[model samples]
Target: MLYFKHYAGALLLLVMVTGLISCRQEEPPLQKVLEVRNLSDLATTEYHITKIVKASDDKTWYKLGDRKILMSVEAVLKAGIDLSKLQPEDVIIDGKNITLNLPAPKLISLNLPPSGIKVEYQEIGALRDPFDNAARDALLAQAEKQIRRDIAATGIFTETENNTRTLITGFLQHAGYNNITIRFSPQTPLP
Candidate 1:
């Protein structure tokens, strides 16, 4: 009777272990949410700026000498949306139609290469100062500002926005989406 009791206990334990092992089955892989964004710069503007500076102070008691400097500059400006600024709610998809809210176009960069800058003419009086490196750098900075203004006046943002919409719409269409709506955030100015 003692042998039978031990044998029965061992058999029960083995059967329970086998049952637990068979009950464990492989599960399907976990699904992750899809995130979409736009970070491509599609439009750019090249600007040529010319400025004449008379480096003279009017408040001087005596009629001081004048130094005239003429500068010509070529710069490039880029505008685009920053995808990192996107939020999950910015994208909406329903069946084959999709809507995306994009950020406003911003000045991505201002490139004024030294080779593109030229001093057209310079005239300095004997008693007046000459155009030094610091003065030239300041002039270049002013040229950059002028280029920005010119780009704005030309409606570069409008062009960029249109290009972005077209590009994104095409991309979505290729990805199996039929209807696409694109809108920009009004809070971000085109400056």
Candidate 2:
């Protein structure tokens, strides 16, 4: 009975030590919130002047000042926003000295055409597996590189690192995902 008690005490002590060690392990900080500038009605619309030439009458008929006035309305919307929500007669734009006529406006939203997550690892010293510090640095570098490439290829409106995060957050928000997290791990080599 005494032996059993000693064994139990040892096991309990081991478990306690393990629990304390695990409690000391710190978790990664949460991703920062990025601010996205809302699109205004004025900056999203424009007008162009085009010359309308008549070939049959051999004359150029201009509607306004020797050019045809063409109005265009463009709204830079977040991904998953319903384009059909905008009506033809909706007051889509109110630019300075330019009231856009939205006879039919085509909506365009910035979205990731194709995005992926990648992981890589770098060895520290002669260690077979990278330690947490090396792993974290590698993961961060990979994420930043992938994010920049994705943004450039997709032509998204990401002016800075914060903007890139904002673009991703906006996409997630539009997709109805309020709480999302991105993670990376060491890449496994194929046999």
Candidate 3:
């Protein structure tokens, strides 16, 4: 009786092992729909730019001498497309050949950290008062504005667009797309 019980137990364990071995995990289905919220503001490129801000208080007719301040400011610029702006009609997939009308690349953010701005040189006239915080801030603001205008000259926008295209193209290719054409759609600023 003992010998029969042992052989039955061994047989049961072998059957359980075979059943477990034959079971396979099912893979999740590939997602076809793109979620815009998940792809919002995908910053593809960043640039660190330094600008020299110099301003002279020479416009005053009664001021005795010119008071000049020179400052060095570093600005961080991030650029990318807002994929959340993508519309259903923007993407057209015809049997693995996909065409996407993506949002145009835009300047995502420009940050000038307070620590990155320094007053390098200042020439205060003997009769003139020193540069105050408000004056310094105004100079920095003007510099920031100029930097924003000059960002396009740095080629950051073009590089950001190219990087975004390469990333999306690779993603689509991996999703089984053979041919991909991407076009940038013009976006109007929201008031």
Candidate 4:
């Protein structure tokens, strides 16, 4: 009788422990979604592009003669998704499978360092004065604008979106998710 009582107590204790463990609350999937949203900007692709800055004073009547300047400038373009746009509805969890709907990637930054600009060629007619600092600054500004306008044609946005998916997929897999599906919200118009 003593042996049976001891075994019964052990069995009861084991059952209680198992029940507590099974009943323990698992973190809701929405919590994980918020965690991802906190990641903010996720820059996935960068492009080092060189642009030509050319200007001529021949068109201006105030100029005595033709004055031209040509310059080369390198720009850094970065594109990525802004995770802060993620909503709870964007994340769908089914058992081990998870589907994350993310906003489409956009231009994160465009850097045109002064050090990246170089004078390639200059021509000042004998009757014309050399290009001033203001002229050079204006030329650089025009070049920057052109680069921004041409970004969409370079296909960087598409590449950025692909890289973002690959990155988030690996991250979710590491978080113990088995089947992962990453979908992007409709892309916003490009600048």
lDDT digits (tens) for residues 1-191 of candidate 3: 99999999999999998888778653322235366437899999999999999989878999998799999999999999988877777888787788888887898899999989998999988899999999888988998889877777888877988999999998888878999998986644422
Off by over 4 Å in 4: 1-25
Encode model 4's per-residue lDDT on 70-170: one tens digit a residue.
99999999999999999888888998999999998889999998889999999899898898998888888898899988888888988998999999999
Rank all candidate structures by their TM-score, best first, as comma-separated numbers. Answer: 4, 3, 1, 2
Q: What TM-score, over all chains together, does every model reach?
A: 0.69, 0.19, 0.77, 0.84
- Candidate 2 per-residue lDDT over residues 57-156, each given as its tens digit: 1133532222111212122233222222323332222221111122122122332221222222222233123234444344445443443344333323
lDDT-superior candidate, 2 or 4 = 4
Error of 4 at 159 (Å): 1.1
C-alpha lDDT (0 to 100) for residue 83 of candidate 1: 56
Each model's RMSD to truth, in Å? Answer: 10.9, 27.1, 6.1, 4.0
Note the Cα lDDT for every prediction shown.
Answer: 0.68, 0.32, 0.84, 0.89
Which parts of model 2 are misplaced by more than 4 Å? Answer: 1-129, 155-191
> Backbone clashes in each candidate structure, one number apiece?
0, 0, 0, 0
What does candidate 1's lDDT look like per residue over 66-185, in tens digits? 677877776766677665566667777777777788878777777887787788888777787788999988888877766666666767678778877887787778777888899998
Q: Weakest 10 consecutive residues, lDDT, candidate 2?
A: 49-58
Ranked candidates, highest lDDT first: 4, 3, 1, 2
With a 3 Å backbone cut-off (N, CA, C), the pairs that clash in candidate 4 are: none
Candidate 3, residue 13: the lDDT equals: 99
